[model samples]
Structures are given as structure tokens and as C-alpha cells.
Target: MEAHSASYLRWIVVLLLVSSCIEATSFSKVKHKNAYATMMYVGTPRDYEFYIAVRVLIKSLSALNVEADLVVIASIDVPHRWTQALEQEDGAKVVRVENLDNPYKHQNNFDRRFKLSLNKLYAWSLVDYDRVVMLDADNLFLQKTDELFQCGQFCAVFINPCVFHTGLFVLQPSMEVFKEMVHELENGKENPDGADQGFISGYFPDLLDKPMFHPAPNGTKLNGSYRLPLGYQMDASYYYLKLRWSIPCGPNSVITFPGAPWLKPWYWWSWPVLPLGLHWHEQRRQTLGYFAEMAVMLIQSAIYLGIIAMTRLVRPSLSKLCYRQSDKSINLVHNSLKLVALWCIVAAYVIPFFIIPYTVHPLLGWSLYLLGAFALCSIVINTFLLPMLPVLVLWLGIVGTLMVMAFPWYPDGVVRALAVFGYAFCYAPILWASMVKITAGLQLSLEREAFLPRLGEPWPPSSFKLY
Candidate 1:
């Protein structure tokens, strides 16, 4: 009786283990058919802000416990590893798609973009999905939005009183609709935005009609719907306009950054520290920390401010410490050094063209080369082509990027070490001189004052003018 009892216990344990295995498999493998989908497209990882936002959107969805099917339609430009992360980490089904043909390919920044606005049209081609919620990567979800799946074939939010925002929309996927939309695009019916939103809005112009109308699925009823609530797609830019004291429109589910792409949340410097800043902070993406990034900015700003500060604070001390030298020689030597430094910095940027010209598209390669050359020439030779501050920011950003990339294409030597240092000092003395001139209330007419133009701007006209 004891032996029989022990045998039965062992058999029971085996049955329990097998049952648990089956249960685990059932839980992990959710079927795609008849499930609602939230779809995004990623063509490149180069757009750091958009990429981070996309990750946050997926993570937020998981946090909300919304089991909607996650899908990413991607182009070949997006790396396979990203597709793997979407599948394994975010539970997404990544469908590879070819970039749509663009008649404006050469003239316009359409599908050939870090913008990738054209890729959104691919959502219409997802015939397998029961319903699709298309979201631009620049959006963040605040709460669970699974109920949107219950929405009709088309549903969107209207941020403006009249114009509906296309960043977020709910639609049923259909190849028939996709082909027709493509046909419309082919015939040049794109909206003013010149993105996929343009083509979509043109195709379905009656979005604002009361009891909104949308395409029926295979002779299904012409289902009409209500507008998506204002809170569903909150444009944070409206904080200064309409939402002053509180979010006047009630609780928000999704926040959309509909402004210039550069002003996105990841760029902490552009956003202020109040209602807008805190919302972005709450998202708390596991990135190189904002404060850490701020520290970098602070260091950069200090370097900038130091020059300005010195110009104001050190005039009394400057004459005390050193003998008066020939001002023209000082200006000429310092300016020449700055020009050399600027050249090294631009050359550092142009290094990629030298190293990986074959990998990049020919047009891109030549464009980068030409652009870098123009920047270098602008500072040293052609001063008035582009304004100074914008060029300075571009130069600094490029230098910072090269520092992070560790000057990869550069040859390792003492020469490389000197080149790096040379790039850092590009604006050092010039910025100081410019500030000194500004503090002293000097006129900086570039055409009239040859010294300031050659030596770099805003400096007081030298009494001992080189000319």
C-alpha cells in the first residue's frame, strides 16, 4: 500500500508540470487575428528623439496592461536589431515594407526622411488586423486606450477648432483603401503638409462631419462615429494659448508634440520646467539622464558664458597683467588660429565622407561634403552666407557628436590629439572678443569693419586698424 501511494504521488506531480507548461504556452502566444492593433513605422534609428518616443509609447502601453497587438512597419534602413527589440522586448509584430514611390522624391523631403511621414500610409495595407490605431512616434500615452478599438473604421482628434490633428487616428485596415489612397497620392492630391497626413486628409475630407462617416468593411453598415475627445490628443503647445491654469479640457490620455520636430521632449533645454517639462519627466525614459545631459549643456554654456563674462569682468585686470601689444598682430594671429581650428572641426565632420563614402548614398555623400565645405568657407571666407549663431550651434553640435563618437574615423596619433584640442578651441578667443566689443558698445558693421570680419565679429573696431 505504501509503494502504490508513492507511485501515485509521482504521477500526479508529472501531470501538474505538463499542465503548467500548456498554460504557460497559452498565455504567451496571443493570436493576432481579430485583435486590435497599434501600429508604428520606423525607417531609421538616426532620429534619436522619435526613437525614444516610440520606445516610451510601447512601454506605456504595456504599463497600462493593454493587450492590443503591437505592430511596427519598418523599412530596410531600420536595423534588424531594432526589429528584434520590438518583437522580443515590446511584443510587437514587425512587418517589413518597401518605401512608397515618391514623384517628389528629388524635390521634396517626403518618404526619404527621418520624417518618414509617408510610411504611415502603410497602416491602411494591414488587411489582417480587425482595427488599427495609427500613432506618430512623437506622441506619449498617459492612460489605457484599449476602448479606442471599439471606435469605428475612422476616428481622430481635432485640436484646432476646425482642423483635425492626424498624429493619432483609429481606422480599420484594408488593402482596397490602401490602393486607392496610393492612387490618390500618385495623381498629386496631397494636402499642404506634404506628408502622409496630407494624402489621408484629402482622401477622407469629411472627418469633421457630424456623425462622422468612414469606409464600410465588405458591405458592412456605413458606421458613423463621434469625434475623439479633446483629451485623447492634447497638444502640449496649447499650454500658453488655451490651457493656462489647468488642463481646461479634463484628463488627458495621450500627449502629442505637433510642433517643430527639434522641439520634442527629449531635448530638455528647449522645454521649460513647469507643466510641460514635468509631463516629459514622468515618462522617465531610461536614457542618458536629463540632468546628465544638462550637465553637458551647463558645461558648454559655461564655456560660452565664460568668454562673455571675461569681456565684462576682466577689462581692469587685462591691462594690469600684460603689457600693451600690437592689437592688429594679436587680432590677426588669434583669428588665423580660430580659422584653422574651425577647419579642423569641419574636417572632423567631413571625415565620415572620407571613411564611409561607399556606404552612404552618392547624393548624401556629396551633400554632406558640400555642406561641410560651405560651413568652413562661411566662417573663414564667405561670412555673410549664413548667420553666425545658427552656424555656431551646428558646429558645436558636430564637435560634441565627434567627441562622443570618439573621433572614430580619425587615425590614432599625437596629431589626432592636437586636432581634437584644436576643434575645442574653435570659438574660444573669438567669442571672448565678440563679447568684449558688445560690452564696450562697439559697432560691428561687417562690411565697413574689415578687422571684425577677418578676426570674427562684434569686436570693437581697432584704433590701429590693419587696413
Candidate 2:
């Protein structure tokens, strides 16, 4: 029985080896097909922000049910937490690579924001795929773009009149082209802008004049570089001009926010100001949700509530100490108390601005800030017996300034900056006048014993300490 079992095991091993060889031979002839690819790297201040943006893009693509694999060419330095989230949560295949050296770093005009941006060049090394659509995180897709795989060796949209936008482009993977690109970089090739945009644009200088690409219906991949219609990459700025899309060719499929980094659609406050931002947030609401920020927001809300309650409880005592009518000998003490009250009011507004998370949904962010400011200002108001309007003018000014800056009607960024400066210039005098009014009111209250009944209680000894 033992001899027979040994004979059966040997036969099984031989059959397995033969089958593996046959499968390997057959697999060598099959192409791996296509993928939608983007890159992620560290060394920038906005690393986490970009990471969140990329995950949203990947999840959005999955929601569209595009007929391609999702790929991320991430640098090895990127945290395991982010890469794991991309793989397990967002359904992305992450390929880790070393950061590509940018030879143009010594150039006078090199922008540090692109320090690790050259890592994007690794997209061409993805030779396993027959075709790849390389993208920037800021690209918002409105529809499935599976047809992009049928384009040629290189295809891009010309959002600018003379230059194609790299925010979204189709490229066929080839080791030779990738090697030549690295060679050109090492040889100090003339990259006018010293960033990935200028380097890639310089490498494909004639794409602007190429004939537009039209994907073959029979699913045949074409050859040569071609220009994609503007519809494939409608700049976000275009929609702001008309408040709607009017692209007349191809598919009005992707929106690229290439203007300002801070105004990316994923940011909660970007919406209503940029109406299209609401669409991006809607996608996020469905897919990723806001759970990541919910805990911090709740904690802040509770702290604000505690502050308001504690201030209310201590109101009569604070008022008794500070709001009493004084003789000439107590005038120095009175002036010092007034300065301290003003400082506390200023801190009330400033403290909340920093404590609130920078990327929380705009509505939540604004709401939390208002709550915190109101809570802190209550201490000052109850103690000094001051009016509400003067304390809140500064808060109102900040909100108004944000609205002015976010107005979508500005023809260009230059106009937007000028408008913000104009608003500040006009509002500075008003803010100063409000501060003077607050000071005057506080002084008058200190000289009168009957400012408010709650504050008219007998004062403690002059040496009394809050501590």
C-alpha cells in the first residue's frame, strides 16, 4: 500500500510541472489590456490633501464602472496607511517605485511644488498594460471613458489654445520611450518651466498641430500621437465663465481644476462658490463619506458647548469684579482691565480659526468656527456688559472676505486677487472704527454703576485674584 501511494504522488508532481509550463507559455502571448493610472508621492505640504483627492478620483471612477483597472504609481516614501487605503478601500492596484530625480532642480525658475512631481514619469514603465490613461488628482469625471483605451501611442486635450493639458492623457506603455525620457532629463534637456508640464510638453512639441483622435468602433488601437478634443478635458474655469458646459465636440466627460490648489472640488467650502464643487462633494458623500472628519468635529462641538455653559455660570462673578464704578485712584486699574477685556475678545475670534480642521466640509467648518467664537465671546460680553454687534463685526468681515474671494464671476485669478484687495482696503477703516467704538463703550460702562443690574453687585477687594 505504501509503494502504491509513493507512485501516485510522483505522478501528480510530474503532471503539475507539465501543466505549469504549458500555462506559462500560453500567458506569454496574452496582453494585460488597459488601466486608468495616477501617481502619488510625498515631500509636499499638501501630501495628505492630494492623497484624499486621488482616492476620491479612484472611487468616482469605480462608481462610473469604467471597463479598466485602476492603478496608482506611488512613490515608496508614501505612508503605508495611504497606500493600504487606496488598495483595500478604493480598489486600486498600487505600484511602488523610487522617486525619479529631477535634473532641472538647479534651474532658477524651478517650483518646489513639483519636487516629487517627476515621479509621474513612471506611468510609461507600466508596460504590462496595452494602454494607460495617466491623470492628475484634480480631474473630475462625469462619465465612463473606456473609449480612451482605443487612442494611439499618445493623445491629449488642448485646453489652452497652444498647449495640451497633461491633467488627463492617454499613453501606450513602452520601455524605449520611458528610457529616452530619462536620458533627455539627465542630459539637461531644455524644459522651459522646470516641471513635469514643461518637460512633457517640450518632449511632444508638435502635438498641438496633430489631427484629432477618433476611437475606432471595431476596438482596434490606432498608431501615432493625436490631439484630443477640448471636451475630454474641459477646464473648470470655462464653466465659471458661463455657469454651464458648452463643449461642442467629443464628450464633455472630464473637468480639470487647474487654476488654484486650495479651491479643489474635494474641499467642502469650494462649493456654492463653484457650483460644480457640489457635484464632487456629492460623489464623495456617496462613496468615501465624511467619517474621517466626524470625530474631530464632534469633539470641537462639545468643547464649544462646555465653554458657553461655563462662561454663563461664571457671568455674575466676572461682572462684579470688572464693571463697578471707580474713583480717580482706581483709574489705572480700570484702563488695564479694559485692555485685558479687549485682548480676550480678539482671542475669542482667532482661537477658533486655528483649532478647526482645515479640510472639514465648509458648512461644518463655518458652523464650528461660529460656535466656538460665540462661546468665547460670551465670557467677554457678560463680564464687560458689551453689545453683541461690535464683537461680531470681525467675524462677519472674515466670512464676507471669503465670499468675495470665492466669487466665480472673476474672469481670471488676477481679477479675483484685485477684488479681495479692494474689499480689504474698504473694510479696514470699518473694522478699526468698530474697535474704537467697543473701547469707548467699555470705558463709559466702567464709569457708570448702573450699566446692567446683574453687573451692579458690590465688588470684591482690589487684591482679589481669579486664580
Judging by lDDT against the true structure, name the best candidate. 2
Residue-by-residue lDDT tens digits, candidate 1, 1-467: 89658645654453344334334423545465333333345545444445455655666666677756676666546667766776787776666655554444544444455245666777776666667788876677778776666667778888887777788888887766776766565555645656766666666778788553333345343344446777778887655343332454535678887876445665443333123544554664432123423453345345435544443332221111122235556555444444544465456346534432221222233344445443343333222222344335545544453453244344333444566567658746665554354323212222233433333334443323121
Estimate every model's Cα lDDT from 0 to 1. Answer: 0.53, 0.79
How far does residue 371 in candidate 1 sit from its true spot (Å)? 30
Give stretches of model 2 more than 4 Å off: 1-32, 316-347, 383-385, 396-433, 445-467
TM-score of 2: 0.79
Give candidate 1 regions above 4 Å deviation. 1-46, 106-115, 212-222, 241-251, 273-275, 286-467
Q: What's the lDDT of the predicted structure labeled candidate 1?
A: 0.53
Q: Model 2, clash count?
A: 0
Q: What is the lDDT of candidate 2?
A: 0.79
Pairs of residues clashing in candidate 2: none
